[model samples]
Target: MPTKTDEERVPNFGYAGFRLDAPDASVAWNLQRGRSGQNATGDALPHNPTAQTPRRGAPPPPLRVSNPKVLNYLDDRCRVHKETINLCKSVLQRKSIDWISVQRNDMSNPIHDVDLVISVGGDGTLLRASHFLNSSIPVLGVNSDPTCPDEVDELTDEFDARRSTGHLCAATAANFEQILDATLDGSRQPSELSRISVKLNGLQLPTYALNDILVSHPCPASVSRFSFRKRSNTGESSHLINCRSSGLRVATPAGSTAAMLSAGGFVMPISSHELQYMIREPISPRDADKPLLHGLVKQGQHILVVWYNEEGAVYFDGSHVMHSIQHGDTLEISSDAPILKVILPENLLKQGS
Candidate 1:
């Protein structure tokens, strides 16, 4: 007899885009590498014999990109790409599994027929790839730099400091092969990461955000006014909350650890089905201004926000892809979409516990 968990496991042998590598400086390198003949390579790099590694029975230290930029950012990331590709090839060759790979810039709908989707880069790459997927296909994220330890002593003005560290990534290049094998063989379980669906004035938006959705004033440092109301389980709604703040963020559980956390919101469990909204810098000093600063929306409940400002914008998952909101425009956000099945390692589950 099969166990209850075993009955729920669905194995998808085919995979797509399993090796997109990115670092804090990948964006800069991608733009200028072709012009400068700069190449990122991981070969000839020395191993950190002293630093304890993961899955080899050694506990990993606090993995922090303190400076936001890692050592030899571009070259190291290139090395990560090289190692990741090699590892991916080796795993597929060993298991006789065929896989398809795509570049980070490809925007076409190419993975509709594929069952499994893999993102090889950091969190940005994962978000970019998810835009093309809307079905129930499971996604696995592989962190390119797992045990990378490089220190840059001096900061330069010309070098870009923005880092693309994969804080939400579950597997590293060193252990992705093993994780992939378990997922293929129906040994590893998948977790449902719910996504937030957005609507623009009664019209459905094309893409949903796996992370948080940001609504803000078009001009920076301007006040954003909006009125929001939530429909209850019985289809009843309380009085509308007139909000004055810098912006608003409606985030899913998977996005709790990102901008929501930095803004002092609660860190929700990745598997939670509820959605949370935080009013950023709520602007009111009066006692009567006791608005609902932050709260959670149940799975079936829907929250509608109406823009009161003439210049307002909506960004999905912090991407440049956006839709403008004008005065009296309504945006409805809900957690009614199908869950995103993300392949997580056993160790991640243990840590969460």
Candidate 2:
């Protein structure tokens, strides 16, 4: 049952770079059925998903899986090593199961639980996998890159993998659970969850992030009129920063070192450390002729972030997307979820690939 809309919406079919090409249509139908929830307009648009559900719940069912297969559809026809695929096939075959290579839009697999999800790429691949698996399933991250420095590689590997080494290792989704446990245990002392604040129209969000949450401006490299309430004066909420760059970003302890760092934002430790908002390449009005900020929003306490472009999109974590952010709309966003646990290698070297 989908929400009523001007035009009929058929579950979540492929919009941009994803779609279900499973063995049959049942997977698509079930996925549509599962996601057939309400949309932003209160109108029930089946297949439309709301932001992250934040009330603490019980642990998700354990994933039933066989050895993992690695694929890099981006590299050659596939980037996954032929050997890894064979390994997964061998293990799955032993269990009378056939391993299907994961596609970009395999999110509609309809399988409730997977025993394990092993990534053979970098952090980016893990991020995308997290989205496809939803927050319920855990993943084992395997770094296949060899050129990375020792210190950086240690966090993602589990086996004794060599640099650019062809080693197989593991890291669990335990980190996310630890962060959640700490949050519930009243140990915000060294919290890893990131606070996400998104203001859409008049909707200011109090969200959390397990990965990175970013705002993509409609215009490229253009300054925009964004407003926010600094943590200092809680009651007095009249502080706005006409940032000169494209957009603002709020990263979790896990993602703080990612895009946030690339944009010159500080990198907070993955589990502790407080790294607030990282503002990037902002425009200065002193040169009004250039009008760094396309426009500004000075409404009530409600922070309004506007994107005035033909097509603007926002990337949550590295997986989800909301493509309709526009003018007259306020986006108040911050991290809303805890860090997603990704298995780390025990040896932090060539053993874990």
Candidate 3:
């Protein structure tokens, strides 16, 4: 047997992506009962006497889909996603690469030891995978299903509504092989994205957020009440400011293009180390001056927030991981977190472009 040369040996990679379809038992049961008069498990449901009666001025019932396979076939997004995954796997196998596949939602998967991580879905999949990763390993995001120009401009009922934006993905099925080769050969450079370091009552959180953190009431309709103050590097503190708003968001530069931009936050340079906070829908006081709604948290500075709500939660990255807080609890957010190494397109790293 011939020994493999250094060039022939490939680094171990961890693969993660979204499933083509998530099976919902309740949805399947409803579809089966509505169309075939039987539940998903093949049990007949009791028939209602007035089920066929049409109410005046009522909206029509939703179209029932009895065959999930047919639905999947008609959905171009699912087909494209599956094809992309297959293509990626074929390329890896052809190159004799060492890799391991793991479910994106499984937090217990051992992914830290891998040399590189490849996320095969849209930005959501990459974000979920990032939750389990540290700064040591670099990640490459592949947009499994990219939207075409025709699809975006056409206004037709036949168009699929579930297309992926893939804002964070730098490669698609067409360019996956070339990009992967470049990444493995040291020709491609990875960007270091700063993360937010969070502390609850002085105890640091184990996970850092590459995107943004949302501090809000558990119920979306309820107001978020909190008091916050800025503490400088020299330990000097600013005056406490109370706020009643929908929520508060603190984002790193990498996350500025996402929810932060939608909420009127500034889009910082991708390489910036600063963290910005934005107050969402603040209820202003008519008698007092306008509150400091948004500001930047530089290195060596941190924001301290005192939760006043009976029950509140802090969401990291997206809605995946969260921590609960009660009244009198303190939460601290800073820019002093570990950095995440990601392979990004050159255009995405440009300042103010």
Taking all chains together, each candidate's TM-score versus the true structure is: 0.74, 0.50, 0.78
Give the alpha carbon lDDT tens digit for every residue of 4-62 in model 2: 22123222211111111112211111111112243211234434255454457754222
Stretches > 4 Å off in candidate 3 = 1-74, 156-162, 286-291
Question: Scored by Cα lDDT, where does model 3 land?
Answer: 0.71
Task: Tally clashing residue pairs in candidate 3.
Answer: 0
For residues 1-353, could you state the per-residue lDDT of candidate 3 as single tens digits? 11432123211111124322111100000000123464322336578887885688776454344655434433444446556766876777687456544344334432455667777777777777677677887778888767677755662343333455677777888998898889888998788889999999999987789899999999999999998888988999877779999988999988998999998887888888999998788888333424467888888899999999999999998877899999999998998887888889667856624
Cα lDDT tens digits for candidate 1, 42-107: 123245567443567554233223333433455454555555655765666576555544445545
**In candidate 3, what residue range of length 10 has the lowest lDDT sum?**
23-32
- By lDDT rank, best first, the candidates go 3, 1, 2
Query: TM-score of predicted model 3?
Result: 0.78
**Shift in Å, residue 131, candidate 2:** 1.3
Q: Which candidate is the best by TM-score?
A: 3
RMSD of each: 13.6, 15.8, 10.7
How much lDDT does each candidate structure score?
A: 0.65, 0.39, 0.71
lDDT of 3 at 92: 74
Error of 2 at 208 (Å): 8.1
Model 2 poorest 10 in a row by lDDT: 25-34
